[model samples]
Each structure stands twice: as C-alpha cells, then as structure tokens.
Target: MPQLQAAVKELQEKGIALPDYPDEPGTDAERDARARYDKVKGSAVNPVLREGNSDRRAPASVKNYARNHPQLMGAWTPESKTTVATMGAHDFRSRQKSVVLPADDVLTIKHVAADGTGTVLKDGLKVLQGEVVDGTFMSAAALEAFLAEQVARAKAEDVLFSVHLKATMMKVSDPIIFGHVVRAFFADVYTAYGEQLLAAGLDGTNGIAAVLAGLDGLEDGAAIKAAFDQALADGPRLAMVNSDKGITNLHVPSDVIVDASMPAMIRTSGHIVGTRR
Candidate 1:
C-alpha cells in the first residue's frame, strides 16, 4: 500500500493545498472573532473549512471532526450520526429492492489439474510435458483458438462455457449494470467460440444457463469441490467463479482421471477472470 504521507507529500509537491484547518487558531478571540470574521467576509478564513476547498481531505478527519463537533457540523447533514443512521437504514431498504440473484439456471465448473497445477493459456499454449516434438511453437492466438473451439463444443453438448468478466477496478453498486454488461459480453464470447467449435467439428452437446443461486449455503471447501464434481457429472461444465490471474492445478487420485484437456478448457473459458475489488 502507498503511504499516506507519501501521497500527501506528492500532492503538496504538485502545488495542491492541504485542507484548511478550521480548528487552527486564527485570532486570539477564537470563537467570537472567528464567527464575526466569517460573517463579515462571508467565507471561512480557516484553510480547512474555507469555500472552494480543494484539499484531498481524508474521510477519517471528516468523521473525527463530526464526532467531536456535532454542534458545528449541521446535525441534519450526512456527517451527523443521526443522519448517517437514517441513511444506513434507507440504504438497506434500497439494496433489498435492487439486489439481484446470480444468472439463471447456471451450473459452475471447477477445474482441478495434476496436483492442482494448472496454467492459464490466455493466448498461448503451456506445454506441461515434452518439448515441441517437431520444434513447432503454437502462437497465443492459435492456442486461444483451439481452446475456444473446445469450449464451444462443450457448450453445444448442453454445457455452458463459464463466461467471466474482467472487472478489476469496478465500483460496487446496489443496482449493478455491470452484471448485465458482463452477461452480454460473455454471451458474445461464447457465441464466437461456439462458431469456432462448429468450424472445428468439435461442437457438442452444451447448454448455457444463467447463474441464479448463491454459494452461501455450502461450506467453503465443499463448495469448491462441488463445482469440480458437477463439472464431471455435467457434460458442459461452466463456472463463472472469480479466480486469481494465475493458474492452479490440483492432483487427485489416479482413479479420478478426468479429461486431460478439460483443465485447459476451463482456464481459458472465462472461468479465471478476476477483479481488483
């Protein structure tokens, strides 16, 4: 994390003024003189409370000031505890109205690799084994194209490809439009991949459905394992769960020989996208 002092210093170096300090003494008379001067000047002389203040004041300071000087900061404003409480209640109600469930009838896929060691092939192939037998190298586009075809085939076989949205730096919202945007974006991706799969004669029985349920009911580990199990049972496993940018692989028993190619499909099929938040 960047240090607050460094940020402040940078701002100062950039000629940005710090927030005015209304609490700082301006005159010996203090309250009376300050109030009189404010009335006469029609502005606060204190740098912290002055009009057109441009200082990047921290929230903590504002909160502290409100806490210590409720009489000064209007009680009806958001800074007041009573107002904040009211806003909180109102926000809760608003969220209840705006809350959206996950997409509809979606089944998630969890990919487990050899010892959970999986690599993400964004636009390239990761050769986990022998060198290019013919010294042939596959480009990122080629690899992505290959994986996209496989995902499409899976989708055709009533299996939906997990569509993911890269929402790093996305702001949280009670009524989120980004969800719709994500759905639309991934729909396009699946469509394109589906077309490629068809061209490659790999399109199979796959079904795409919206994710409608929450994972709150299951334990953490159970939920993770359940995703993998469902992928095995379901023909076209689709998971939209968030993943770190890196790839992971899990080694399971030899008897649990899932498809060797399935992990690659899951990693590239939009299941591994992440966000900053």
Candidate 2:
C-alpha cells in the first residue's frame, strides 16, 4: 500500500486528486479508498477543460443530414409509449480539440511493450505556436457523483437506465469508465471481491460478462455471481443490449455509443432494443 500512497502523492503533487490506489483494499477506509480510485478512474476529464468554451455542438454534417432526412429522425409524440434514457460521463462531450499548428511541433507517441521495448506510435509533427492538441478522466469522486445521480434519477422515474459512451474511439478510456459504472452499480460485489477479481486480471473497467467469466477459477466465484444476480434484481431497471442473452448495456464500453444508440433509440420511438419484455 505504500507504493499506492506514493503514487497518490505523485499525482496529487501534479494537481490530480487521485484516490488512494486500492490494491485489494479491505477495510472501510480501504474500500472507500478503492471506490475513490474507481470513481476517479475513467470519464472524469471533460468537465475541467470545458471551462465553458469547449466545442460540444452536434456536427454540421449530422445537422444537415437531419434536415434533409427528417424521416430518419423521430418525432416525440405524446402517444408514443417509448422511453429512451441515456447517460454517460459529462466529459464524454466535454471533449477539447487542439489543432496542429504550422510553425513548431515536437510530439510523439510511443508504444512500450512488457519486455521494455519501445516503438514509435506517432512522430510529433511540427506545429505553429497557436496550434492545438487535446487532453482527455475519472480514473474518483467526480465520476462517482455523476453515475450515482444517473442511477437515482432512473430509479425515481422507473425507466430503463442505459449508459452511452464512446468506447470505440476512446478505446482504453471509455471502457475503463464503463467498468466503473459496473462497479458503482454493483458496489457490494466489487467491494467484497475486487481484490480477488483484480487477482484474476479483472478490473472494474471490463464488461460485466468479463468479470463473470473471470470468476471461473476463483474460490468464491459462485457466491460472487449470486451477488451480481441479486444486484440486478435489487437495482434500478437496466437497459439491455441483448435481453435474450441477459446482456445489459453496461456489459461493454463501446457496445452502445451515443451517436449510434441515440439515433437508434429515436428511430424506435425512444426505447432501447430488447427491453420490450
């Protein structure tokens, strides 16, 4: 835990209020610490940089297409018996853009392998002084509040809750956030077994199915699974990615992105697929 403390110190020194890194944290302090770490892990970056000037409008292409293809867009009617609910980290849209300047630039991406090898991912292009680049969140408290509000709202409204994240584009980031939502939704299970799960190479950022699958050889796997099942029963209704397979939207990060899922929900008159039952 000293290492975690040191890491936390390092981040804090750099202005990041990172939670105490939880490596099999057990006590309430540890569990709370873990929760802190999880909440802060993914999807918590956009708000800070937004500073109210970030670009968040729908793209021109989407608007123009919507205008030309009204039929493709859905009209909200009072008689429509559909409810499409969507939520994601606020930073999901709080994205900033940096342009490549023409004058001076020296930025490069490197790929490091486990064997201590390095490969260049991108060579920094020369850029002018005014050129921009973007930085990307919740790896703690900020994200936990956002997700909790979403769950509480959905519960009060009695509507299916679905999270829409840019898992594909974000690749590592979004999925990690998705995992946090999973952990938040099933707090008890993770609190009790996060240590074990982490041992199994599972973290809160993978699909629930992955966690379930990762439980394969662990001793308390069956008991933990039961907890997950009970969680589904006790929590707010979740939107399904495949109700037939008992797969929920929180199963994978990129499974349900906003752009794709939002329009699809509209097309279906505001309800997610596989929730008719």
Candidate 3:
C-alpha cells in the first residue's frame, strides 16, 4: 500500500493524476470509485506512467503479418463498391444534457479528503454527464434490425455482410454492443436462457460465454445448448475471427475493432457496414 501511495504521489507530481484511492468507500459513488481503483491499481498505472499515453502503435510483427498474409487482410479492392456504416463514436450517450459548473465550484471524484472535503480534481471544468443507454439505443433489437437489412441486401447482391465494433478504448459501451451482436447471432440461446441469465446476473452485454458460464446447475442447460447449436446452424453468414475455433466476431470484444475491421471491408469490397467506433 505504501508503494502504491508513493507511485500515485509521483504520478501526481508529474501531472498524471490517478483516481483517488478511497480509505473507506461509504456511498454508492464511493463504492463504485473504489471498484474502479481496484481494477486499475496494479495494471493500468504503469502504462500511463511509462508512456504518458495509452494508445500504442502496432508492433513490427503485426505490420509484417499484414504484408505477408494479405488474405488475412480481407478482400479489399479499390473499385466499384458502396457500403452502409454504423459509427458508435458518440451514439450511445443517454439522457444527453450539459452541465456548466461555476468557476468557484470544482469537480472532484467521489472520494473525500480526511477533512470530509471533496478535493478539486479538476478546476475550470465543464462536463456533460450521462448514463450509457442500454437496449433502446443499442441492443439486440438494434443489431437484429440492422443485420436483417444488411443480410437481405448482401444476399440479393451476393456479397459478404460485415460488421465493425470498437471494444478497445470505448471500453464499457462497446462491450454492450458486442453483447448485442452475440444475442443477435444466437437469438435462440438468449431467448431460452434469458430469465436464468438475468437471475444469474449475466446479460448479453457480457457476451454469450458469460451466459453459458452461469448455467451451472440449471435443468435446461442441455436444452439451451441444443438451441444454441441450432441457432448457429441457421443464423446469417457471420464474419469469422477464427474458422478453426469457430470464433465469430461476436465471440470476443476486441475481435472486430472498427479501425481494423471497417477498412478491411472497404478495401476488399463492401455490403452494409455498421459500427459505433
């Protein structure tokens, strides 16, 4: 704990502020702050401290692979193609409202100082705080409607239907979109195990593996498994991450990164591209 404190202090000296580590998290906000602190405690700080930034350029090997294994790059051609794209950049913001704080008022994280004062984490600040909207804005229903249209268009023109998502930096919201993709792809699995899933505190936003992982001792596990199998058999043609392991784009969060995935489609050719990058 002393080492962590010293490191955080050093970062603060360098103007690389880390979230305040709560001594005792009391309220819901404090508890959430503590949970976030726990996650970044050992893992996240070093990256920022050492590099001063999170975004890293691609490794040499990755560039080599892109050159050597061109087919892995997707069927990108420079001519005769049009595509529909979904950009997630700022689409998932819910209850969009702006708040302008007076200059005398400061915005601090939820943690309070020993004197019970909220320290000024940021001064002269402006914030537009909003909850991430689930379902209505971006959910399985949304993915289905999109895929239904794209799949129809792709089949009509005999082209590949592809999707783009960014589960990298957008972190929280993109994972939810990824979950929607999973539920849309495996509609039956979700329909069958939904109640059990919600009861187990699992949702499509966490991915289908989470739902399956929570099926510990359920009576309908086998039935859900069968339905999942059938959904795979009948679902629309999905972009594959790994054909050998059957890793579809929706199987993992970072598989279909928008920056990487969308360009690949545009280069190869395009049908209807959708993303919230």
For each candidate, what is the lDDT?
0.34, 0.72, 0.59
Off by over 4 Å in 1: 3-5, 13-15, 18-143, 168-277
Model 3 TM-score relative to the real fold: 0.54
The candidate with the higher TM-score, 1 or 2, is: 2
* lDDT (tens digit, per residue) of candidate 3 on 1-277: 3334555677889999655667798888788888987665444434543454755788899999978887643455576445665634334444244444333232443446569987654454322223221232334455567655665664466444455766666576677766665665665666767787666666666665666666666778778767777775565555666666666566667777788766666564553243211
Between 1 and 3, whose TM-score is larger?
A: 3
lDDT of 2: 0.72
Q: Estimate, for each residue in 1-277, the C-alpha lDDT of model 2 and write its tens digit.
A: 2233445577889998645567898788889987865664554445433335556788999999978878655567897645543334545345444565555556776766769999986794433455565544232566777778777777787778788878865666677778778888887777888888878877758788888888768999899889899888877888888889877888777678888898798786787768632
**Total clashing pairs in model 1:** 32
In the range 61-99, model 1's lDDT, one tens digit per residue, is: 888987887642212333321100112222323334322
Q: In every candidate, how many clashes are there?
A: 32, 23, 9
Q: Is candidate 1 or candidate 3 better by lDDT?
A: 3
Question: lDDT, candidate 1, residue 188?
Answer: 43
Task: Give the best candidate by TM-score.
Answer: 2
- For model 2, how many clashes? 23
Model 3 Cα displacement at 13 (Å)? Answer: 10
